[model samples]
Target: MKKFRYIVCLLSLATLSSCDSILDKGPLDAFTNDNFWTGEGNVSGYANTFYEQFLGYGNAGGSGDFYFNSLSDDQVGRDFDQYPNNKGVPSSSTTWRNGWIEVRRANIMIEKVSQMTTLDDAARNHWLGVARLMRAWQYYKLVRMYGNVQWVEKSLDITDEGVLYGARDDRDMVMDRVLDDLNFATQNVKDVASKTTWNRSMANAMKAEVCLYEGTFRKYRKSEDSQKAPDGAGATKFLTACKEACAAVMAKGYSLNTSYQGNYNSIDLSKNPEMILYKAYKEGLLMHSLIAYICSSTQISGMSKNAFESYLFTDGKPLALTALNKTDKAPMVDGHLSLKDILAVRDKRLSQTIDGVLLYNGRGYTRYNVGMESTASSGYGICKYDNPAIPEGFRNNTTKNYTHAPLFWLSVVYLNYAEACAELGAITNDDLNKSINLLKDRAGLPRITTAIGFSDPANNHGVSDLIWEIRRERRCELMFDNNVRYWDLVRWHQLDKLDNSKNPDILRGANVANDMSGCKADKVGEYIDGSKASIRAYDKKYYLYPIPSGQIALNPQLAPNNPGWE
Candidate 1:
């Protein structure tokens, strides 16, 4: 029998009756809120409830985190003109509701854990750290979306309406509190044996991520309001914190997996050295459709032409500056390079991430190729999460596909460390070797040194040559995983890259003229539902999402919706 874990416990808890008897008079045998706080097991079980919410590979049949960047410059979806462009002011948002819900849950856990007198100091501190970590995670997300969110440390009742409907706190104030929580988590969260559970390393990783975001956001954002930081706490302070946190994780003995492709397309990552935390999916108990989505003949979205071209050549030089691109013109076919040729000279990760050849019905590695299947919108199919080893039956069934999802990994920490160093303006070649060069070595590219003085002409972000290269490496390494690209753009204050009018490359897809037979010679871009891919005009207001209209109405303090929306 498979060992029942957090996910199983969560599923079992969901099926329980919500009757008054069960609510008021908690069952003696089963764990309830009233009885659950008595032991470590129950406290751990409660913490498990947050795992699915924060870490799990999304719903079985959904796109999961793979398509999160569809709204950003990295990838273009079938609905190209969706969010950040056509986003509307809603009355309420699940993002707002669910965030507060999770925050309350974390606060409740902290309160309950504190009340437990039986637990030893170590155990109590561990559980408290877990709760604080969770709270910080939610707040970090909330702050990212809404600039100045209300900071609630404790659970509030209806009687505490003043606290509930209080004015939005300063971003710096909330982030400082978030930093405090992360510090507590990093110091107190035990180093657990289970890779799936939260540990001290994971806490440090989370802190690094949070600090980098805030630090860069403050440094890059032009808005005076957005740049505000608490006394003695600004970009330098947070970035230093980010650097130290990353260094803490680096000392924990994590390394990159042998194959870059194996990181994403794995069934078992429990023992993978790169993984700090991963969501385990059993064959029968819990599975996801991400692998099936990649393997199936379904018309998935593709990376943007800009994203595809961002990968550095094998020589660690951008295409414009690479001699290989100038010398070898054979790859060029009908004004665009063939998919095979494109993947050949660029970073090895390109081939691992995207299909090297056009795959359609009765073609390529797909097993269940129904005639109704269509090619990806961009003609550049995403193969990052594809696993060819799974049997035919399993690939076709959404729920049966059992690929593990990496929630946190060492590569991200490496990127975090490198970027933090670069942003701090004190990066050394030794720092590059310790962080970015390791990733370069894994990607089979020439090692980058601090003396890389040449700048890519594509440096539209106005960053230094080193910073630009670091950002590119980050983009390539973390593509199609989570919303890294989107958030990176946001923090760097470069969302204008999404403007199709300004950056036409973002809307362009694969060069399908040569390989895809029926594709028009003139129309080289991805077509969706008989229309070419496009994005609406970009606005500065898109930097921060609008606080829901209803939320503003209820509080009035949240008036003046995010910049352009007003």
Candidate 2:
């Protein structure tokens, strides 16, 4: 018989509902220590719940934390007045508080699982390895948005008097906590079936991500005193950690997807060798956010044109005036170049990362979702995770009906690898060959020599080339995963570029219409919205999100706004 244990007092807004009160909840009478450690299947089932929690952590109903929308570079809603401006109140901040709460649950689980001593050494280690990894996973998210944050080693008992009050820790300390957990897991965890399982490879891949962010952030902005610039040597050391972690995964046999499209094709995802680890969304297990493009009129109010048009034509045709381009006006050439042609002679990844082709009746053709027409736009939604054969209208909205949401994947591993290589100035032909070859092979294109640097110094790409190449690939490879243009700008110290005081043209837009074939042509690119209405630049202080106002009021130490808010 299957036994169960209910943990009361779950933490985090996006975490699993454990128990209403940690102390109030009683352990299952069916099984205590005597029967808990009996089988592999039982232990594995518990691990599975951790995976499901990643989706519930985010706001699917568009109400909770709304972190997804806050990351949008497309448009801001008037309904939530402050967040549009990036000003959030702590008391009202679900994402802010939930993140901390979520990490605590992970810590608690790790503690509980470790204490189940009935298992042998190997089995015990396996569970411990995953717990360590989950600890790292939870911290990685916290560090990313909040910068320096609080770290807890054990689960807090909500019923305890001390549970209600906690203080934030220094950023470096939090990072150290992440590293501690990752390093321990890497050493103890055994290999598993694939990235899909709660396995060792996924944990290591996560370490690579955290290391890169810390190293880069510390190197670039390292000020002995808060206002000073980062030291040079720090950058080198950080990149070293990033490179080693990426190479470790590469040695473990991870590679990029053969086709740029293969990385995302719903049918191809489970088998994607390039993905280190990703969350599984069974038929009834997840929520679909891909509906944003479901239909222009009839489809759910999804698919923002602002987000869609950011994708440039693969052949260097700039969709955004701020982006790089070859032509002056829209449709400068015939039929707004086909997806294959736009990607011509450029990096093979352009097609692999975005919705570059259309599939119909088991055959792929040139049909594309034109932004202006709800019918045509709905004709082909992003194939990233959708089952192609499932008729067009079945599960297109956010009613929790069309279940599927991926938390992570191996593509991130490859991207992280690419970033490290480019930073080290050691982007060897072998490196490019490995990365691009995987993509080209999938696109059915002939692989070329990796000698051509997308940021070749000979091409006068300069240091900016490295930044552009990595960031561009990131945008193309990970578009609509609830991440895109805006944050990249913030990370690269390019937030100033968004400032209207200096670069008024960055936010410029144009009025255009579609051709008969369902593609919009930029007749004349113009900047209709100016500094007053449309933003050209961002305030440096806004780089780190505001420490929700309500949070500060509750705990003086906890609520100090990120640098600029006051």
Q: Considering every candidate listed, which one attains the maximal TM-score?
A: 1
TM-score of 2: 0.72
> Model 2, 512: alpha-carbon shift in Å?
3.2
Please list the C-alpha lDDT of all candidates, in the order they appear: 0.75, 0.50
Q: Tens digit of lDDT per residue, candidate 1, span 189-284? A: 998756888799999999999999988987887854354432324888899999999999998889899999898879999889999998887787
- Summing lDDT over every window of 10 consecutive residues in candidate 2, give the lowest-scoring window: 1-10
How far out, in Å, is residue 175 in model 1?
0.6
| Model 2: per-residue Cα lDDT over 169-201, one tens digit each | 777667777777877777677777576676667
lDDT measured at residue 519 in model 2 versus the true structure, 0 to 100: 35
